[model samples]
Target: MLLFITIGALCLLLTIVGDLVKLLQLSKLFRCISGSACSDELQQQLKEARVKVERVRQSSNATSHYTYTVKLMRAENELKAIQTKLRNESNMQNLKGASVELVVGYLLKGVLSLVLFIITLRNRYTPVFLFNENINFEPLEGLLSFPTGVHNAISVPFWALSCNSAFRLLFNAIKGK
Candidate 1:
């Protein structure tokens, strides 16, 4: 059970970390785009978006889990508008790099999941929940095996998001908006 809980927590932590990393990357992308041959209005908007992301990162200190959660939520909400604006402004020719990044991110996640699954299988498909005790049994093994399923299930949405992100980038680029 402890092992299950640990895996669950790890999944949640990874998801949050992924979002934070994306926020920072998007912020940097906005800054870079702003410096390109875009309109002054677009440049200003991009800078504002980057500033909002920076503020979220600063406020979402990991000192307390609750504080981090709240701030992440705040960051996500704030980013929605920025995302929409970027979607409006995206061009396929310009976002080829972003599309590549999306693919790389998905592949990395896939590799990580595969490695974890391999590790679990090597450990006899049982997680070491407690240090002093062996947590192996038919019933317990059945129960413990659920963590991998849970982890996989949890990762599905992130994979979908990766697909959506790549598709949106392509679609917007093709639309020439």
Candidate 2:
């Protein structure tokens, strides 16, 4: 049980790390989009916001933290402005490529999760050829099953988002929106 819990925790940690990496890549993508859209002002806002966010991170007191929260909100608003500007001005080809990449990533995640689910389910139903018949570890199935379930849960939203993005991009390409 401990081993399974440890594995589950490790899996969650890995997922979080993966999401952070995705966010970092997205920030870089935003920078590129802003540059191409001639959003110098928005870029400056982001830089300032980042600095303020860092300052917020450094502060320990609640009163100062509240002020930092305001700064963070302002920063988020600026980010939304930047996104709007980029959406209006970014190159269609670049946007389409990015959308395609995102779709592929999401679909791949969904496919892998499906595969894991099938494998775990099969293991649960079938005999363990490698293990002795006298030895039982039915509890271990919970470990495999739980992780597969979690993966499936996480993958579904990504798949949906990817599909939605891809369809929007397709429509935009067709309509020049």
Candidate 3:
């Protein structure tokens, strides 16, 4: 489980790094065309730069997609292996039940971690006002809150659903139906 978590984290990091690199490269490509234009040579250079940026963007996108697919498949395989191991170790017939328990455990842990992180961050950065005498608003609050809220709200449900689907497939595999 720890290994799977680490792999997932690494995959996420790689995806983010790949995205940032692509964006930076695209920015540089755009910056290359910032001079006074309309000359034939300048126009040709801009056209070529645009083409190269497009190609780079497409390739990066394809690579990102491929990496995600591979990671997902690997995760699925790991889950399947866990299920098999559990079955072989115990003669329990309630594989679905066990899967449900596993999913619930994961969801609870993830949500708790998110809540703790948010609380810690809020405590660290948010100013505590006394008696509502004065209020201070930081410009970065919205930026920070939006992503944390969005990630916790979106990713938890997405992962839960994916786990449920994966468990269903595992069930099917187990029944040999």
Candidate 4:
């Protein structure tokens, strides 16, 4: 249906916008980290730590500089991995995409219901011609209103479940389990 398609398109657009915002935030965070103004004492501490580390490396009598360099690189990689894990956990807790998708799905469902209502009106008996046996019309109208509410009610839980399942799968794949 045109209504459902339109709704899906709009939801896709919203998802893109949300992703862009996230990317922007990440960029901003990176810039902040690179541009931060550290106190002189902290800078001094870092310098001293670097010097101490270098001294320790030199005293260790490692066979080659290559070994020290490789070890340093591996430590950096581990630190990055830990930071990435923390960020991912925080993002999951926020459920940013799930919230956005839930809203979009509900809106789409409402549109679908409205379109159905319009179609029903176009084909139904004239409003003015109330036959004696048309006592069911009021109840039918009530029934017609149910789809929109049902759609909204179902979307949040559906999205939540989907996201949870998807994340679990992703986690398993990442862990090679």
Candidate 5:
């Protein structure tokens, strides 16, 4: 049926689009691809902090003057502070990005599934495919016929499920995962 085919295509399209969006991973892509100005600046600061600590350490023997100890401790503390800042910044960005992606993925799935549900309800009495003695199982025939009460006819709900299952399986196979 045209309705069945169109609905199947829509489901396939949505599944592909959702996977593509997941693959894009835009937030992490932007942050990782360029690691842009802010991250670069932080990296530069981290390097300078390490250099400062090393310079101070090299300025004196490990057990030299009290002034040297104070300088070395201060430099090391600065280096540690910078390292912690960089770690925290990266962790926060990852958490925020993942959270946003999770929320968006959840909403997209919910809304699209809702649309499919509405369509299925509207076409509850419609037969997605008609068969003549193709399947002889009574319970299955009863279920496949669904609201239409037509023996050996598949309904929209099962068709939708089959479409989603087949497409997702094909997609994963193509992705080699």
Candidate 6:
């Protein structure tokens, strides 16, 4: 019972924190904290590419019909490619914060899931709630018990899921959404 309560509380806490992070829009701070090395490098490359394109355009003979020379075309393509890369980098940076937090949240959730699995496996025969009278709903009993074989039981995973659902509902209600 103590283990169940502890696990329920932890699951509730994790769900609440995950919700808060999304609701508060703290992803930008996370992205900033994650650094801007990729964007910075792309910007530098964009500048160099622009310079090469400009130099190629200027060095070509103005009076000649060969204006679209191979060098100039190649430089222009490189410049355009770099510009595209920089644009993509900026876009990715905008999403990075949210993605980073999502990954961390997933990792924490995974650890919690493992703990639940271990707990359930250890207490396979122990019913979370014992019925005073026998209830012969085999399918429902099996589902409620899940990893545990105990009849009329609520397993750790089920309990944790309930805790998460309850907390999320409360959180959303408090958030007015």
Which residue pairs of candidate 6 clash?
none
Model 5 regions lying over 4 Å from their true place: 9-21, 30-37, 61-64, 133-139, 162-177
Question: Looking at candidate 5, what is the lDDT of residue 57?
Answer: 77
Predicted candidate 1 versus true structure: per-residue lDDT over 1-70, tens digit per residue: 5545444444443344444446557544644655355445666776776787677678655458787777
For residue 94, what is the lDDT in candidate 1? 48
**Each prediction's Cα lDDT score?**
0.51, 0.49, 0.43, 0.45, 0.80, 0.73
lDDT of 4 by residue, 4-74 (tens): 33434433443344344454454435434442344334455545555655655675565567777776665
**Model 3: worst 10 consecutive residues (lDDT sum):** 124-133
Instruction: Summarize candidate 5's per-residue lDDT along 1-177 as a digit string, tens digits.
Output: 797877887688767766656777966864575446777888999899889888887888755699898998899888898888889888877877777667777777777788888888899899888877865758678877778887888888878888989988998899898
What TM-score goes with each of the models?
A: 0.33, 0.27, 0.20, 0.26, 0.74, 0.46
Candidate 2: C-alpha RMSD to true structure equals 20.0
Q: Model 3, stretches more than 4 Å misplaced? A: 1-93, 125-177
Candidate 2 residue lDDT tens string, 41-89:
6567667766766666566465576787886677667667766765665
Q: Give Cα distance to truth, residue 141, candidate 2, Å.
A: 13
Model 1, runs deviating above 4 Å: 1-10, 26-90, 125-127, 130-142, 145-177
Q: For candidate 3, write residues 15-86 as lDDT tens digits.
A: 234333444454334334432243344445545555554555455555677775665565555555555554
Better candidate by lDDT, 5 or 6? 5
lDDT of 1 at 31: 46
Clashing pairs in 2: none
Best prediction by TM-score: 5
**Candidate 4 Cα misplacement greater than 4 A, ranges:** 1-86, 126-177
Alpha carbon RMSD to native, model 5: 4.0
Q: What TM-score should be assigned to candidate 6?
A: 0.46
Which sequence of candidate numbers ranks them by lDDT, best first?
5, 6, 1, 2, 4, 3
